[model samples]
Target: MSYRGPNVVATSNADEKTPAASRDNRTRSATTDFLDPLTETEGLDLVGILSSVDETAYVWDLTTGRLDWESNAAEILGFDDTRKVATGAAFHALIAPEHLNSRLEVFSRSVGADRVRGVPYRLQYRLRPCGQRSETEIRVEDQGRWWPGADGHAVRARGVIRIMHEEYLEQQRQLVRNDFDELTGQLNRVRLTDALGAVLTRAEREYQPCAFLMISVNNLAVINETFGIEIGDQIIAEVGRRIRSKQRGGDVIGRYSSNKFGLVMLGCGPGALRVAAERFIKAVRETTIKTSFAQMTATISLGGVIIPDQAKSVHEAVNFALRALDIAKSKRFDCFVAHEQLPPAEGARLRNKSIAEGVIAALDDHRMRLVLQPMVSTKTGKPEIYEALLRMERPDGSLVSAGEFVPIAEQLGLSRLIDRRTLELTVDLLKRHHELTLSVNVSGLTCSDAEWLTTLRRLTAGNPDVLRRMIVEITETVALEELDQSVNFVDTLNELGCRVAIDDFGAGYTSFKNLKRLNVDMVKIDGAFVKNLADDTSDQIFVKTMIDLANSFGMETVAEWVGDERSARFLKDAGITYMQGYYYGMPFDSSDYVKAA
Candidate 1:
């Protein structure tokens, strides 16, 4: 018997002219004899068993590249003739190009491994039958073991190949589901962003133009409230469909958020971006959407940023587009706004970027330090407690005050780190100095930061003295913004034995009811009203009223920004418990203050 194919020599089984050929023939004979018992069993249906599982067993002669398969190999592999898969080279030719390398790599890596018992391998790949195109390709899972020859190379492999057409189809469907939005049948946000990054790279390399637009359906919330959420969803789906229809072949669109869609337009310049945005807005606006409950007219607002011109990176592209979209919405319904870099905003962005880098570096380099500002007792003219102020030292040793970086840190979501560090330093100081009473400010963001609270709990745990002497100060505006969360935060601090003070109080003109609800231990008068208390009658009345109300609630009042003897005397006469300002003393380095004390 002889086998013939492309890249394969017609070899006679009886010839065995070479040692490798002789070994291959012997291996084949041994494999066939091993399966002969199964075929001879009268009651056991071997072919039926293999067919039931859509599997075909094979013994591969690696040295001769010859392949021997079970009787059902051709039927299971969807080949018209068994000769099509008679050798490894022919079988490799049938493997889909995309998966060919993977199949080869698996076997290559298996070579030289422990082959006494054989090296086991399993892989999945697609195979195209002879005369069949890729659309009709069959997916098969091939799992087997191979034995190495004396040369430490794979010489023989015996394995089972199971057709996985159904599983392959399911996997393809799952991939589609993962890469596409269910409602819009468009690329999902993750895939769309990936595509955006790819296009941006191409644009930058080719020096072409691209634009990313953020289109928001203008009254989605109102529609949801007036009709129903189901109707709102219908509107969103319809809008997505309309936007997709208007997109160019090369353009990509995705549901970016609930009411917003992101469109990435290729080779589009500033002029083209505006035109595309208007076209998309018109597509959704000109036609009314028919929903389950009612027919509604939905208008969309568009904001876009041209790539490499107005935005350089994916993050900048998304943010700038959203910013333009906000401006468009503010102007009117069915509006289009293209992002133009404003000097001040650009400067601020650059400043923030620098600050963010500096902040992270400072934290890593242990350059963050605390300065103590004394809040003095107005009656005794003595420091009662010190407020811990955050300061970052530059590489040059110049200190950056909290006023410069704290707001930016909060905006950049770096406040939590700073807040945690502050807590640790404050607790440390309190533990070291038995006479020290310190106040540390907590950002509004930290109130919701469970990790920060956990850190606080861990540091002050079982240290009642430290907790009692520490005051957790929260600004009045922050407290009033989220009254319930603020109340809860204060309650937790109180429970932990830490005193809670409403800092910059009277700044928000906090209602008496809300103030009482806070249940705080003290209120720090807003400095704006206290600094000119002696000269400004209105400041005096506001301060006096705040003091009276705070006193009535049994809450102590600490006047801030008191800069003169008259203001300090007036605060003392007005029942102020403490006063803090330049008039009392400037902020001292915590270490220096500790040494001096």
Candidate 2:
């Protein structure tokens, strides 16, 4: 068998035009099919039985000129997942190159005259997980025994089926979910917590010091924004698999952040963390993650902590381990840093105080003013309605951007108030300017607030125009992850004659999935790539592609950071429909825009 050979191609065996009754009997019963997963009795369904069998099992026949594949078999066999597998040349293209020859060899033996009946052939099987791995193959054997049943039709011979108890199945599923990041398919927070915690406790019980390693990628937000979430998830998954392969036994590792991973050491001390950290850094630097683009590398800041008593509650120790990771991140350490080396804080007081006070001052003086930035019609060069910007004034009467205050408000439990203030201000602003459409920013936590919704309803009750001309820029980064609330918020807003735009469109956990399902109107390109638009060809291609993408979906694209003429011109010529920038205007007083006009 060869990579280019047509002889190995599999053909579809599925009946394209079979009778309904025949299909029904061959397929799982409707109830069993509709209810994902079957009860013990329902497991008798043929489809259910197929699903319950080995994940990679395929009813393959190289002798059959036609290639046909089962959908489950395709997923297990590393092919493009389809309704049913196909046989023939096209099917061979999807098989892992390493497995094809061996599979063909097995086919030769399974059908030959010398092959003993009921004999099972053990094969080392590798099913590449679409893109995550090279085929983490498990060795399994194929047993062949055929019998003429009462109907005189041939069927595969097997033993009595042992149905798993419902409770056991549910528990297994929960365990899998706990251990995996759904987006990246790497281990998630819960899994990491359990795995690392166990390692730490065991180490402590053994009275041996253990190390914890944490790795975080920088500019993940920008990467996510540039590529869209589907690609970002792929990159993250690849990085995780690489790291996992490098770690030795007794070390537990899992996704710790949207762009970070945590590792726990069993017996290795501080030195082990150091060694593993070095290996990780090297792997990350040398390795290029495969996305739609062929190659890309990520920069990671790593940190570690060594606990002398590994068994004495490593969970809390993980916190200390995280603190070190933060230190490494904040310091921009290219390599790894240890926990003991952390510097004492000069209080980060100025930062926290500025955030806390900024909100308080904005609320007290009503400095939280809503300024509208038009999402202008690219075709008409006229206003399409404006997106809302919330500006705050300090005690000095200087205007502060939301960037400087939003994070602080969130940390201090004041985002809901800020959101309410912004919404109220937006409504009032709309009342004053009936011709303008205003967009307001709402965070995840705010969207989940019932009181805020009531506040919004009340504010817009008396003025229909205020409600009609309003658009809310819900940041995809926040809104999509908390899907139910996000959808409800958008539905309510839409009912109130408001539209919703996904803010920071590509910079989130599940951008593509959200775009496909999220109830949103427009996409705001994040400012980072736009900040350096003209000079970076890669960034330009990225931005241009996203603009095209939004247009294809009947959504408008807004170029953020249209900071200067150069970027504005670049974005404008690149077919971007709308641009927002300091070049056109810094978010200013409504009076300033009016005066300028």
Candidate 3:
């Protein structure tokens, strides 16, 4: 280190100092000089302190392009000689190729004003030793202050270089964790989805073929139930490993969900997709997963869609692949289904998309209205309760029935929203109309949705009268599907002073045992059995048996679809508690009913 300019000093008169005063003055002068500029000995001490922490200080003279580094620069930067890093140009050459321009841009950015103090900068990059291309490249953090020259450009900089290899490695690990699944070590769903979109774009641009496969572990739910979830996770991890081993070099695999994986195969046509699917299937089926608890054989079902062919976008590709997966699962435990763009299916898909958009818009716009259909008492033929059916009013002043869009809503995972909205409307109606009793149907998805129950409790909280007038109806099929959850749901409703009815009863083979366990308040016989009850003896017997069963359980029975006087009379004679049908009255808008009342 060298000083190249005149040094300014403050001098005291020699006549003013006594012998003792001279000693004190000398001590003060030494301290004052240390602050002006570091002497050679002090500079060496600073270098020693910085070097102990793996840091090196430097001073660059921009006009001369000379870099003066501390004495330990060679040792700190892993260089054999100090000359290699003694100049700005020589030092810049050692910066990794990718980081060279970025490091230079830091100084260039500090060109204008703000030189009153100095422009400060901090950046991290890799540096490779000169003439050595090995994995030992150093990661460094360079932070410094630059001063402007007369031309308003950076002329000199003072900074420190810190070795950041450990921090850099930790950051790399975090990136891996973000992009990959913890259990399977495969790409996570988010990264996989991004990768799918990218591959689809590339395939379209390059006019190449590719395929996306959604592979699901068959009977995973049963496995999780039979074994523990931990063992199930182990199975999933092992399956991911097997899939990775069988994938081609260009293919990508990711953990799509708990029991499913998504694979993207580049340059794969429909025929190649089938072959690849089979290869993956065979790999998992042939090898039994050995876990610490137990060894079990697992098989996977796959659904595939060709890129830029069957599907063009990421959304379409994922949806189509899931559809194919459903078909494969329905066929058997281990099967592969390839998505085909049939005309009818395409039309249905478009229609579903339109309905989904409409549903969302209607909900947002508060266009979801309820229609009330009367369920009349069997003995006196007077309206007992009104069933609230969901309807979406269109912009054209027409209405779309729940049947037209509810299934799609369920498929698109919008049932919970609709259900919550319905609960709110029903509670409001019950509060407004003191003489009204209403039954509202819920989808299967809502049966297990804790949020829906929370919403229900919130809406009817402190208003037990409203809950008492409200009847929550769940389909018989849904109730039997997850009997335990349905039982709990029914119990909660009953506990809240609300009645639970198994709607569309007798549609599914509901065992008397399960029906008894459900402990519902009412069973609405399937309209199919009630519509022809007057003429069809079989229908009459089934209806009679269902009525008998309900009566035995001390549950009320509501006969639905009683289209004519004869059906109603027969249902009433068969001891039905309530009857609902067009013959009694068509469903009318609840607001209109309110106005009439």
Q: Each model's TM-score?
A: 0.44, 0.41, 0.44
For each candidate, how many residue pairs have backbone atoms clashing (under 3 Å)? Answer: 0, 23, 0
Residue 543 local lDDT, model 1: 93
- Candidate 3: Cα lDDT at 124: 85
Q: Give one digit per residue, the lDDT tens place, for model 3 in 313-420.
A: 888899889989999999756989999776998778877888999999999999999999999997766887999999999985789999999999999999999999
TM-score, candidate 2, is 0.41
Residue 306's C-alpha lDDT in candidate 1?
90
Worst 10 residues of 1 by lDDT: 1-10
Residues 1-597 of candidate 1 have per-residue lDDT tens digits of: 222222333333432343655545644553364366766675576767988889888887767777777777778888876555666777787888888777766665654678678888899887887644546677899998878777676777888889987876698799999999887787888988888889888989999989999999998899899898899999999999999888999898988888889999999998988888788888987878999887889999999999977778887888889989999999855799889887998869977988999999999998999999999886777998999999999986989998898899889999999998888888888888899999999999987778977998789776889888999999999999999999989998899898999999877989989999999999999999987889999999889999999999999889989899999888898889998999988999999975655
Error of 1 at 200 (Å): 40
Off by over 4 Å in 1: 1-342
Model 2 accuracy (lDDT, Cα): 0.65
Each prediction's whole-model lDDT (CA): 0.84, 0.65, 0.84
The residue-level lDDT of candidate 1 at 520 comes to 97
The number of residue pairs in model 1 that clash at the backbone is 0
